[model samples]
Target: MDADTPRRHDASPGQVPHDLLATAELVAGGALRSRDRMWRAGVALGRPLAYALPTTGAGSPPMAGAATLLLCFPFDLEEMPAGCGYRKIELAVTFDDESLRALDLQPGAGWAGPDGARVTAFGLGRNRLRWTFEAPRTGGTLSPDGRWAQAVLASPAPLTDVSGRVQVRGVIEHPLLSGTRAEGEVRTRDEVPFSLTRADVWAAAPLAGRTPRPGAWALTGHESIGPPGERLPPGRQHLCLAVDIEKYSTRGNADMIRLQRSLLRVMRAACARAAVDWDACGRQAQGDGYLLVLPPETDDTRAVPHLLDGLAGALAAVNREPHGGTRSPLRTRMRAAFHHGIVHEGDSGYAGSAVVELFRMLDADPLRALLADDQSTDLVVAFSDRTYQDLVPQGYEGLSPVGFKRTDIRVKQFAGVAWIRSHGHAGPPPPDLTAPV
Candidate 1:
């Protein structure tokens, strides 16, 4: 706590209660004794960690005037979109069944304060705190590995009670974000924001900050968050992945049902592990295939390899379970295609070369033939030529040039190149590609 921050030392907050929010609310807006509602002076616990809720202790007068709740999101600074980057943050922090008014802007690194370009923060209702952090424009990029995009909510002096859980919803605008990640669009949990596609991204700990103890404040649920303050140009760009089950139509209905159920679970688990929120993606589910137009902040290099690894690990787990008639060794062997490019959403369907390219790699005869040749492999993936060049050669974890073989695509009117990697590949096989040099 800075000396400049306002503080009142005449009173003291109650003992650390089980439900801090409930107690804080009463103290914030409800009536409380002079002793229960005043800040204790002489406390200087400067800044709290990204994932902690510091409390005031017993003394002549407690010093932590306002309780600060910090939320550490899974966003990496480099994953920010190139389209005039900005982050939309909406948080629900209330006392007395109403919104918690703002006190001071958190001067933490990697955040834009109130003076940001065209900020509409203070004008919003008290039910939620809304802000858009202006970021680098086109041709510039933000810092790398700065994964903690946090919201510091400090209580006001008059009512020194800020506690309990705060629900947060945030998105770095990439045009596709507003339509996809709009609050309440999907009545389910949002995946922690990260592009499973980046190499530098670190997995979020179960809690944020160095000091994590039971009953600490948690940033868990997100209710209704507002749209971004500034709108960017609408774009169809996305890092996309296409998946299809092998011989899906030939399977009996019983097996088909099992596969379908397993596919959904597989995707959910993969997204959870990758820090790629399922809601951030534009999903188009086919009976035997699926297309995921991933969030814009996802990087192909990190997400591609990470998602591929997730698919392999998760599919292996599914196959190990007793499935497909009397404990079969495997029941869900599938093929996936990875690509990053434009993907269009319309009133009826999605149309774009990116979509076409993804499917071409997925359904191409050679990629299918490889899957058929290696029946023991649980999953096979094909990366677009450009996508492969961007990732595997960069020597990222879980990706290797020697493990991938270039495959020629001759599906329909679309013809291109794809690099294939099958599960349990021993090494690079002899070149069998039919594509030209």
Candidate 2:
């Protein structure tokens, strides 16, 4: 055959060359058509039924044949129950004919009948050809249920140049496939307990469609309910107040520090007006008494503008130092689950109290009056770069009395938060003041 032209299978008599007989033998032996026939012929030719000839010689020399025969197989077979008739036979071949020496071979086996009852062979190479056969399906019926057949092919050397065609010519005898569906639902309930003073009943409702806000701080106060000399149920009412400080971190900025102090002063003034004892309000000089719930550390760098603005207004009222412009606007984003609640005992007598009870009260009612003023708010605060440092008092001033005295306080700087502890006593005095100054 010419190097640039394809060899016709039905060439005129006397046109087929003697050397082409080997190629003809490959075709006639089913190497280019049926897999079963090819296996039978290979067995007859001393080649194992499972042995496939390498397209290239042992030393990697290319095969001298016009085309490397890769695969051959009959198309359709009986379908198992619950199985669809999907047949695919692929062959990787290479063409060495004069007209298509560089062409790659790809032949496939497929079925065409509506029920996959008809089989055909097709391939793409120097050109495309389709071969059809009218043979009845002879394989035993596939189980009514679907079954799986898997085969793996491997070669020592990469089968790069081997190319051939697969001709599937048979009828399918099984039915189409089907699948099963599962049916079912689930339900649950969360019961959170809560208690509130008569005045805070309205504030107990959800804010912005969220759960009711928990109290910011809890105060355990003993009030004499009966005669002064009478021992009426211990003559003291233990009041546990919960306070929730929203945007605590945002308010930790320098500006907000001043504002917070001013707010504290205002709260004190309010307590004075209400004839409430500010000392008994559970005020700790060192750290914020309530635990602060913080989000997992994040990479967000946007400072909360509203928090900064609020701090600015608060500082102006306190007449304290204004936050320098060193504040970076980047604020860490906090998820709802990031939370920490702390309890401070102004009297030092409540340190050994149940922490769970305190936390539960806080979780149930996070907005309660800690100061005599009944100024309820969230306990947790978000901090900004410049303000975070200013609000978080450091050293002895930031350490709780119990923490400073017992040396139980721990301080570390990570992701910008300065942490301190109060071993269990009220926090230390403010930095700007001395014992007798």
Candidate 3:
């Protein structure tokens, strides 16, 4: 039979079968409990299949190891006139196999609905049961139609022979502005069901600097930034960045200073070439001896690429310089991190906070300090328009008129040479040292 077909059954009064009644009793008594084991089992069955099934659709298949028995009744919503009421309540029977089905057997013969409830029996092997109810005058709550398919699975064997019923309730709503909102609940036999309301999904459209290049690094996170009716300039926007830096050193304070200076020079030059406004930037010295900030940038697409190129040149120059040895480990680490999108972009305000937090965490870890010290100096560059606005200088705060539309580039390093060259030195240093050899 087609999965959508509804089954109908009318059990004689007082002659209702025990198994059928037991299933009803379990549901009525709210006996189906959610256990950690059950949840894990459901996950094991549903996770793999989640990819194949439509995440948001009525005809979508149910989670694995789940069986559904729904009964439908006809009711006029205009009569009840209560708040959005339910026209139907679908009863689900989730089990692993035929043996478990025996646990639900009723002594009597046929089946019947509870006074006003409607019933249906469509599946052949006791694997399917569907019911429909005519919603009361008040509208009925909408749920994921996929659950209908998920409710019909063989009972899973218990880990320790302990069994409980779990009610997984999900509400799905679609609004004109915000798109779709889906909320889920998991209720155990004993404890109250809790809603899983965390919003973890984020999405972003491709920006200008970065193209959807095949065989490039994995693109995972996505989020929508602007609200409907929010005015935005028309143009393709993309932001791509990489970071590299030298390692940090606890014992070598002098070496650390030298390395940090090199990193700072690279960052400053990159910002300048990118047309970023330094006066509007905010700087912070992390307790771990690293500096973090979000300098302002012109609202131009070319800013990110220029910053990246400048940073690369700065790293190469630092490596060849003769100040306190060739290169430092901290710089190398920063560079590697940048290449992999490890650093967060500081565009205006909170955008850069995540990166700063990560840096602070690394500073707090003793092992990280040692590794940063010994490893080659690396670079971390996050390109964006929103860095921490709080970090920006007050006078220049409103200078970034573009708001969230600007491009930002962030650079991080453990230690490197300073941006400014010491005076009284030779003329222009060596050509090979300064140039990208």
Candidate 4:
């Protein structure tokens, strides 16, 4: 450990912290100075530098003949040359045996320094690399939340020449890989196979059901209550925005997953922009849509319009742009319902009449008819009568009485009146459903 590197006085003599935990603070601080020096030293010595991977593997390194190496240099690609992202840093080496090995250039691995950088490999190449890195055409920069672009070496051929050190420097803006949109969704490149939220990773594995434990049991009125003591308190009044993608079931599983995720991104972004805390919001994922519960203190009257406006902008942008290499024009529309209700906080999720009404409003036939009737409309928003009376009449930034048509909503167990508005098209909703309640 360097002198400046803090020593853990908490650990007894033989107990050193894991290499990763030990250096996490340094890594987070963006201290690449020493990492660069180490890379340069490895280059001068003409030896392969060993970097620890995030996960553990079998003791033996995969054989050179059996496995290909991915040398990732996670750095800003734009700060470098035009072709630098695709440029391969050739390291001269005598392979124990050449069996058609291909190497990839990727963003730097953890603890790797700038300029004089370190390379870390996750696994051998499993598929052919494709050229996906492109600067944003919309004049957007990297995500303000610290998302970075990566330069991947597309199409791996057998490496013939390998020798010496290859230098990589700078950062560049690439097509949105990950970032927060104006709507507040964390946009991750669809090409990335999987993205896990911190909650996803840290979530406790599901048990069979509510685990019964030895505790103080109480009988309430006519039933036995929780062994933990009393039943959990009911969730406070919250603004619930329930959104569902139109024709979500029409697509195949793969496409459905993609579309749903995209919708979620937009929803999250919109909520964020509306001043609703993404992490704090009670999120319950349904198949094609979700139920997002805002805190009691949220200005629902102000928040709804902001969310809708941002949501419209986000959907428009996504719909206008081409995604991946698929020829299928990405098209999606949503039906959303805004309601306020107290939810019964459950171990798995929130419950209450509010949650039920929101879902019912989303699945309303009138909302469906509206989307089916207007080909250009990408989103339709409905406010429960209570919400409309409380917030809609306020003339918030993006809302107005004239903009919405009053409709009687009756779907499943839901019976109520709501005000509906459409985005991406100009016109009143179909007269059949908008008739006098």
Candidate 5:
């Protein structure tokens, strides 16, 4: 009845045609457009919080829905083994109770996008799911430009939440590339450039109160996300570990790619032997390193030391095997640092001061100097004073206080007392290796 609003026509009593009402009902029931429905659903879910889409071209922004929620998960294909046919990614989505219940979730089959990606695995949580995607066959290529590709959740459900805000979180495996190139390898021989802005991201709303049974979500509670009741991911204490390859940049692209892939396989095996549950732990694959987070409630205090011992053992085994290459047999050396403190899961991934401290520990000058001087050491692991004091004194399996020496270290904003432990090199540092530490 507003002056400008259009009103449906009303004819005098019987003036309307016989099938008009039925036709109107059918249209109302089935005519909802996908985009329109998504917009309406998004509005119903809550107020717009924040969202992002991958940029295909410049000047013009990427496509966005009315209440459109866009997400992306980027992979560094250049760091991948050439012709690697299968690739997997774990996705996490978070949303509130009202919005969650309104959803018509078809977990394994819900995703839509590029031709190569498929949801090969998935796990549900009260507010999140561990969604795994296996990219297209050998023809699929992950880009090095950081802004490689993206995925879209085709169906948007009407959401009902009081906060009027939404959130998304994701991680791009192998976000960077190392320098090692294999013989006959066609990859870049120099270090691949990196920048944070080009990173791809994806996010899912929290599953508020839906308790997905064990099989419903793989590796139940490998790492803790948080108890739901959110404005954001609640801050909690976590065991943080940062692992980096020593002199990784010195190898050619082929060698770098192979080294990282082989090292990851070994690392996973080590975690398994130590009962570390690498998959369950919040893990992110850096080009030449990894950032792992273990929630306090799920990871035992002995987890760190046991894993260190396992890593040392695993590295030795890899060295003992016949490496196909002629120029110095490929050997992997690593630097690992451990710390425990408050960390919060955020829109991007895990964040907090503790996480930053762990990275700082890895970059500390003393740790680097120790590795350089001890050419015979294959692995050098450092523990934050708190973590060292709490776990080192308690002898747990292969972990003993004998090899650990205390050291004072500083890097940028962090200055601290830590304990350094060395694992004797399996073989001489790949001869004359001048790679950056």
Candidate 6:
């Protein structure tokens, strides 16, 4: 070959592994597809991650945060991708606010992150609009790495103050798995309360025969209400369980994402095996932690053992396999708190002294110290005196008080007694717990 022949770019410079680019292609046309099949086939990849954020934008009429609610899902293709918003959704929204008159919403989906992305206008009729967005494109919206593809709600039109709550049912279909319609899976849906003030965001309602203006709705905010849902009555007493990933903030976004997925699976699987009806429980997501308000009928006998044992078994199984991500394999370890008390639904979330006490136990100095000192342990639970007395002393089927040790908890304005238990060994309480209180 002539030396002057524009040698392949690979040979032109120091470029290495030039053929690596040969592998990039659209999987759509392939006869076999969807992430679900891969999951069923024993792939260790975690399930999809999604959540809803409700924000009130500032405008002539303060837009209802629900209108500016951002619907997020995930999509992967080449470096750049194109998609239609509604094709991948199968969700039903039930809200109690009667004054929520429909205002114009923006439609038309492209990438929803960065200056390079665009959210065009689309008229909404009967208010059934949500977009499963591009993850990488909208990294700026939710995730830093473009994991949550987002569809911002059209506009807010709350005639009165938010007097009721909104609930989302059904699942967000994975675009790649259009062939397999998985049902009743634990979908990622959370309420993000926003009090930001802006309007001129959502254009006019683009109902029938009307076209929504492109790039008209751009909802923005800084402060947000932590994600939580008070699905049960506050005065009602039930079992409360809360769990947090140890050292969650120390991990990168990718690791955090993987851990969150694993944690959910562990929770759901444990509940199922324990015969706990997860849906019946009032729940909330606390970034790195999760709280559950068990069903009123929950039998402490079965609930305690099942919840703890299931968590341990599931954690062992998942830890054996690497979760979804490019980082090193992540091992699941958490600190859990269990207490039985009356919980109330606050405007932002479930509030009450019970909620506060549960957190105090979970974050108790002894619990944190035990987890930190014992690296081999995967989980440590601090059961309030109420929980310990109800289960362990009553001779429940799976309850064993063998290694549990009494630990005094004094956090903030609360002072109480808690029993600490790790997988098989309960470490000594922190110095503070033993110090003069």
lDDT of 6 at 271: 73
Q: Over the stretch 180-199, how does candidate 6's per-residue lDDT look in tens digits?
A: 43222222233212121232
lDDT of each: 0.48, 0.24, 0.28, 0.45, 0.46, 0.50
Over 225-299, each residue of candidate 4 has an lDDT whose tens digit, in order, gives: 356767676668888888888878877544564465456556655765566666566667677887888878888
RMSD of each: 22.4, 34.3, 27.2, 20.7, 22.9, 17.9
Q: Which stretches of candidate 1 lie over 4 Å from their true place?
A: 1-233, 425-437
- Using TM-score as the measure, what is the rank order of every candidate, best first? 6, 4, 5, 1, 3, 2
Identify the runs in model 5 with alpha carbons over 4 angstroms from their true place. 1-230, 322-330, 395-397, 424-437
The lDDT-based order of candidates, best leading, equals 6, 1, 5, 4, 3, 2
* TM-score head-to-head 1 vs 2, winner: 1
Which tens-of-lDDT digit does each residue in 337-402 have in candidate 1? 888887766433456878888887888888888888887787888989988898888888777887
Query: Candidate 2 residues 1-437, lDDT tens each?
Result: 43212122211221111111011111221222232221111000000011122343332222222122222211112222242222222112222222332121112135333223334434343323344432324442222111111111233333333223322222222221223221111000111111112211110111233211112112222211244565323122222222233344554333233233334433333233223443334332212233221122311122122222222222222232111212324221111111122333322333323233333333321112121122221122222222223333332233122311111112232122222121111122122111000
Q: What TM-score number comes out for model 3?
A: 0.25
Model 3, total clashes: 131
How would you encode candidate 3's per-residue C-alpha lDDT over 19-104 as one tens digit per residue?
A: 01111011112332323111110100011011111123332222221222111111111111222222343333333334433212
Candidate 1 positional error at 328, Å: 3.9
Residue 403 Cα positional deviation in candidate 3, in Å, after optimal superposition: 30
Which candidate number maximizes lDDT?
A: 6
Model 2 C-alpha lDDT versus the unseen true structure? 0.24
* Runs in model 3 lying further than 4 Å from the true structure: 1-245, 287-297, 324-437
Clashes of each: 11, 71, 131, 22, 30, 21
